[model samples]
Target: MECQVKANPQVKEVVWIHDGRPIHSFMATGNVEDSEKGVDSDLNQYQSVLNQRYRYDHHYQQQQGPNHHGSTIIMTNQSLVIQKVHRSHRGRYQCVALNDQVVPGCKANQKHQYGVSKNEQIRIRCEVDAEPTDDLTFRWTLNTSGTETAIEWPSFTIVNKTISIATYRPESSLDYGTLACSAQNKIGIQERPCVYSVVPAGRPDGVRGCAITNHSMNTLLIECLPGDDGGLRQHFNLEVYYGPNESRSSMKVLSEASAQSKSFSSSSSSSIVFDNQGVSAIQHHQQLRLHSNHSSSQPNFLVSSLTPGTTYTLNVYAANAKGRSQTVSLSAMTLASPEKHVARARDSETKLTFFFASEQEASNKSLYIRFLPY
Candidate 1:
């Protein structure tokens, strides 16, 4: 950043100001040295002069355009490019002609903070081209990329050599790179950066789901589209939330099925049958047992016999290469046992007339009757 300021010619001396503060001033005008030599005064001498004569001041705040009427710096260079810069070089700046003795420095430079996305652990970093001894300050901007213009200074920091900031959620992931980090001191300002990205603990996303179905008093088994065709295996983890309370749920690990592993990526559409894969189990009221799958040994669970009268709620979630399906909920209720049948037999000396009583137990189906000698 840089600029040029014209001399007043009548003022005798020239001075630069930023936001009502003095940048620098010179004693009288026409200060250019006509006779200078020695390859522009050795690099070391030039460095010494720059450090002593032009050290920047960090206390001044930036002034918006329409600010202070005119350009402030007297600059001969096209642009002010700082190399290996640090966080101490941030804020609005101006260059003014100080009696033709020095050129103005640069244009205003703004800085931003860096951070991770929401629900994420990754962190961002900052760097600059300054001495380690410079006492740098930091300021961050939030909601920089929203629909509305959210760019703001909001606050600033002054302390040790560096600043580490951890932003809270809702304020963390603002959708774009709008946040600015301003590092300031008496001479200049530099800003560090922050980026936001959320990552779950496991499986890329740590949301685990489940569902129970097909129940008998002894067990409950779930039939899912196979995830692993014998080539792959999976287990069901059940965390039961009982009654009406949600947080009161206890974790119950249902059994796993070890069918032979087969991959869905195999060139066959049938390889994708496990698209119905899900977690399953059998409680004391519902038990899940490994059953023989003559079809393809693709591990499928069996729900065993269950108790009558009790209502059981089963929730099932299915997942595969495509993605996880929504949870499926079901209920099972047991029925009462059937009574045995009794009949009178005909005696050898007496002919007996038989009367039939109607009791429906799968009576829509027919039954066979036979007589044998005692």
Candidate 2:
């Protein structure tokens, strides 16, 4: 690694910085008369003071011995040589010349936008970078519709001389806007503050492209495409409804009391049956409810213990802290069990019989065999 320096004022010293820390430095070795000959006398005075404040370790010099092979200074002090360089040597490298002062700068390690609920508090953090962090201070501001206001104390805290945390809450619509944080030191305040936009949380978009992937006499496999989360964490829900295959008008109507009484146990919660006025008064079933934290490669649901040869209306909904999304509906039917069959054969002196049983009969009954002369 090499960093060449060419300055009119004759750089008083050069420091090699790696990952925000000084690793090595090269100081000019000459008489006072040679160092005083510079275009800017004021800058020369500043460099003298800076050299006193900023000190470099002699670790690099010690590594140049014959027993050491870590890092060493080569032909010129401007170049650095590292033996057996590996992953540990990977980082930001900077060549800093002591001539002027720099102002503080800050950046936030968060997304540009945040979804906030009404009266819900949120915390934001900022990282400040500057020389001489001893007298550093921080300030926060809120900007809404071209109007900016300073955030008072008790809402922000500074830690470790480099990080700042601010707590904020949006009470009304006007509080939704941009929040910014800045740092200041003995040199000067930051030119630009770290900014983040705040927006209101909303209902998630409805699931899409739902279809019955596979079905059997008592099970069905359904898959759907997920939608946007509406700037917040969201969950999924599947509702199953069973009704007759006839027209809507001819379908049977169930009383509210009867619908509520027909509740079944499930993994998440007890399922319930309800009736809609225009449509058939079908029996509703909560097949599955996945929480927001539930993660899967694909949004799929396997519904079991369903009735065979039955038509069902499936509705999928997405929900978040704000509200639930519109329903994405799909109509599917469970396969009907095949009928049983019997086969018989007779020879001159013997008889053979075969019986194929239906699913229910196979589960409930046992096979029987008999041998008799024809």
Candidate 3:
């Protein structure tokens, strides 16, 4: 509260809310023209109960400085003249006439900020001095290249002190463009980026889909789901384990960016039952093989039947923008028989379907039918 309000001393009072509650009633009383003389005008002035009571209540007798009011003084101005002042004078002030009248309070001078961990995990927050105590808010945006460009750490907060906040990243924002979060108060605010650089992750943060099926006792056609952002990767390897022994015996398909189905076919014939209550089953073969860059429609094999009934483990790795990712391991056991299955033929392909074995193998999210050469 510094500038002297340009008032004809006509308005009765001004009101503002605080902590979900309204300020107590106030009014300025007495005459207005001789305000400098400390006398209220006959027009009737508004007054507010200062934190302290004026020692000399008889208008002309009360001291000009602060009074002993109920609330603590946040600021104090000792300057008698309104214009000849410095920053040190503003403090808890109370004006009492017959009614309460005043200008907007000092709540319009605060700000807030936020932060995040790896993977764009975030924590939004804000901070400032203090006014009448209100709330705050924040917002963010992205750039065309999919980079987070701007941010308003906290949205619109109506407060001045420290602001508390929490936010979550959209599970689907693979693009991760420029983002901004803005923290707003009554009339003032501050902002920051949700992320400084909207750097596209070299490796896709999302990718899923790879299950096993049975067409033959020795072949396992595993359909894999690839990522759209990352095309082909560099440096890939696979490990196959037969029974308790380790070996390499499956073909690798490097062209898959989304869903893929490759089979591990072997010449040996036997039978290897599945476990995990059919949730998953692995076939072990004596060998592992990588297919010769097949056509677009060919299945990517992890193991090509070097020996049937032998268990094996597959370790896969792909290149990413950040660098190289650790290999992912999958377990598989070659079938006991030689009935190797492949792709399916459908006149009306409803969903992505693969021909494995018996209709019982069909999945809810996918179709696994093992029948004639579709």
Best by TM-score: 2
* Arranged by TM-score, best first: 2, 3, 1
Clashing pairs in 2: none
The number of the candidate with the highest lDDT is: 2
Assess the local accuracy of residue 139 in candidate 3 as a C-alpha lDDT between 0 and 100: 42
lDDT: which is higher, 1 or 3? 3
Question: Candidate 2 — worst ten consecutive residues by lDDT sum?
Answer: 56-65
Stretches of candidate 3 off by over 4 Å are 1-199, 214-218, 227-239, 243-302, 337-374
lDDT by residue (tens digit), candidate 3, 75-117: 1221122332323223333333222221122223322222222
Report the C-alpha displacement of residue 40, candidate 3, in angstroms.
86
User: Deviation in angstroms for 140 in model 2?
Assistant: 1.9
Whole-model Cα lDDT per candidate? 0.34, 0.60, 0.35
Q: TM-score of every model?
A: 0.23, 0.42, 0.24
C-alpha lDDT (0 to 100) for residue 191 of candidate 1:
27
TM-score of 2: 0.42
lDDT of 1 by residue, 77-130 (tens): 322333333232334444333222221121133123323334543332332333
